[model samples]
Target chain A: MPHLAVNNLRAKYGALEVLKGVSFSIEKGQVVALVGPSGSGKSTVLRTLVGLTPVTGGNVTIHDDKIDYASSGSLRRARDQMAIVFQQYNLFQNMRIIDNVTVAPVKIKKRPKDEARADAERLLAMVGLADKLNAFPDQLSGGQQQRVAIARALALHPEILLLDEVTSALDPELVNEVLDSIRQLAKDGMTMILVSHEMAFVREVADKVVFMDGGSVVEEGLPEVLFDAPKTDRAREFFGKILRH
Target chain B: MERILEQIPRFFTADNMALLLQSAGLTLAMTVAGCVIGFGLAFVLVYLRQTPGRWALPLRVICVAYVEVFRRIPFIVVIYLVLFFIQTVASNASLFTIAVISICIYAIAYTAEIIRGGLESVPLTQMEAARAMNFGRLRTLVTITLPQAWPVILPPAIAFAVSFIKDTALVSQIGVFELTFRGKELNNQGYSGILVFGTIAMCYFLMSFPLSMLGQYLEKRLATPRSEQSARKIRRT
Candidate 1:
């Protein structure tokens, strides 16, 4: 059984329907990359999955547990099972690097401070930020901030991690550091749904590539199948433009 | 100067000194009580943004009106209005209680606005990040939002305390014998008006200067850094 499933998900912002009847599922330990042009609702899928954006209509089930939008308990449990790394690194500015990672564990999970701190430190070390345990978010570079965001997400021990254009905000030089960390996470078998325009990173790291255009999945297949052999004219055009550079 | 020095002992004789001390206590008590009430209400007003339903607007409007009315009215007029109107209903209440309660009412309104500003200054992204972590609304507020908001709120709050201390002079109109009121009484006694007023001014300065310094220190300490160290730490680790 798939670890996560979204069947016919529909979401809107007032009258503007951004995600219209979207559907997808991820097996345990699979890395699914959501590729798309700007304004294609790729990020919306990740946001809706976390319940940040309310679904107008749909079913999102994780580990065979049905997520009911109306039930606070179930919704919270579903949310806890997943973590998201934003396009812009969203580290809590007030907290130190380790504290940013340890906060959810200590405060929400009710773990003791020492235990949470240790876990946070370990996660930071795993993300290559061991020396920055006491440093604040503002003290780090953009790539460092994104990695701390990853570490912060991992500290929760989430079943799935959502990456929404995680490297889009970084400088050209900083992009490689963040993408390298993500590639490492994929290699370690963490289930990830990534929304990105970095075609090369997506091609290299994604186990399955999903191409979306205008709020719908335009094409999807194994990275090689989608990139090398195009079935749709839109996919062919997109690939032609993306691979040319 | 010699005449002023001689008059100091007469001016602050036992009974008068007692009254002055009592007044000082009342002034501090009023300031503290008002600030507490104001901060509490302001938290509610600002947190109303997170509350569901259409009534949030009405609640916000009412809070705005409370802030506007008290902030516009002179503290002297407010003290007199409350004393004259409320004394009829609570006839046994002491003048000290009336003065403190009036100050509290006035201070709460302004403090609420100050707190509201602090709460608003916290970026929405922080709250969203907390939510993504699956923290319940209340827990997120306590741990993430408030902790972050406090550093921003403290400087203005300390500034408010300085102003509140100075505003205590308005209580003299209602016959509170705080330093300013004592100075006025000494002035009425004649011969050392400049000395008495100057001493009172120095007392106000002494009361406010430390708090001003504290506000400046906190503002400096809480300043947000420009670099993104979290990202760097991530790379190094």
Candidate 2:
């Protein structure tokens, strides 16, 4: 069975429906990249999965356990199993980098403080930020902040990670550092669903590319198949436009 | 000028000075009681006002209407209303309690706006990040939102309370024996109007100056994020 399955998922922002019966699935250890133009609801799918967006219709399951968005217990369970990194990094401006990574584990998960701190140190070092643990979010470069955000999410020990345009806000020169951290995660068999506009990074790291347009999946397959020879005209046009430059 | 000089000795007599001291202390007491309690209730008001969903629609409307109505009413009118309302209900509520209730009602309306603005100033993404981590709404508020919001909230909140040190003079209309009421009594007793009122003004200044200085110190202290402060502490150590 797939580790996660989204069937006919629907969500809306007030009067406008952003995710119109979108469906996809991710097996354990597979990285699925959701790529599309702006406002295509690619990020909304990730938001809905984490219960940020109210899921208006349909269902999502992890490890074959269905999530009932209306039930707080179920939604909380889903959130505990999945973590999302946002485009803006959204680190707690009040917290040092070390606290940012360890806050949830120690405070919410009720782990011992020393254990959380040690894990935070390990994760921060993994993301190439061991020395800057005491720095504030504003003190770091955008790429460094995003890497810290990743470490923060990892400290939660989520079963599946979600990346919503993680590197979209970075300067071009700073993009590689974050991408390198994600690439290293992918190599270690971590499952992630990423929404990205960086076609090359998506091509490099995504195990399967799911092409989305107008609030639904247009085409999805292996990265080579989907990128080189999309079955849908919409996907072909989108890839043609973005990949051209 | 000679009349004023002679009135100074009379105005500064032990009995009169004691009355002024007592009145000034009363003024400070009511302002602190009213503002601190009101500031806390304003947090509850803002939280209730932000409650989402159709079920909470009426609650949100009530919260918003309370802020709007209280803010639009004059402070003196609120004092009279609270005084009469409390008298009708209990018939024995102290004048000090009535004064505090009036100031609290006024402070809640104004500080609620200040607090709501401060909470909104923290980006929505911060709350979202907390929510995704299974942090409950209240925990997200206390742990995440409130910490970041303190800098934005404190300066304006302290300013409101200090300005309110003067506004509470209106509470004297109901015979609270506070600064203004005592000043009026002293003036009525054949003292120089200039001496009595001028001394009263100095008392007001004396109370507000230290409080505003404290406000400035707090603003500067909290404006530096705890992360940076800890880093500095590490370097010093």
For each of the candidates, give the backbone clash count. 16, 0
* Top of the candidates by TM-score: 2
CAPRI grade, predicted model 1: medium
lDDT string for model 1 (B1-237, tens) is 899888878876787657666756666677777667766766776566457556677776776677788889988889999899887898888777887778778767777767767767888878888888888777777877787778778888889877889887888887876677877887887938877777678777877788799889888866644354344556899
Q: In model 1, how large is the Cα lDDT of residue A240?
A: 87
Evaluate residue B150 in candidate 1 and report its C-alpha lDDT on the 0 to 100 scale.
Answer: 81
Candidate 1: list runs displaced more than 4 Å.
A112-114, B1-22, B54-61, B188-196, B224-237
* Fraction of native Cα contacts reproduced by each candidate: 0.86, 0.77
10 residues in a row with least lDDT, candidate 2 chain A = A236-245
Candidate 2 structure quality by residue, lDDT tens digits, A97-173: 99999989988899999999999999999999999998889889999999999999999999999999999999999
| Candidate 2 collision pairs | none
Model 2 per-residue lDDT at B43: 94
Docking quality (DockQ) of candidate 1 = 0.56
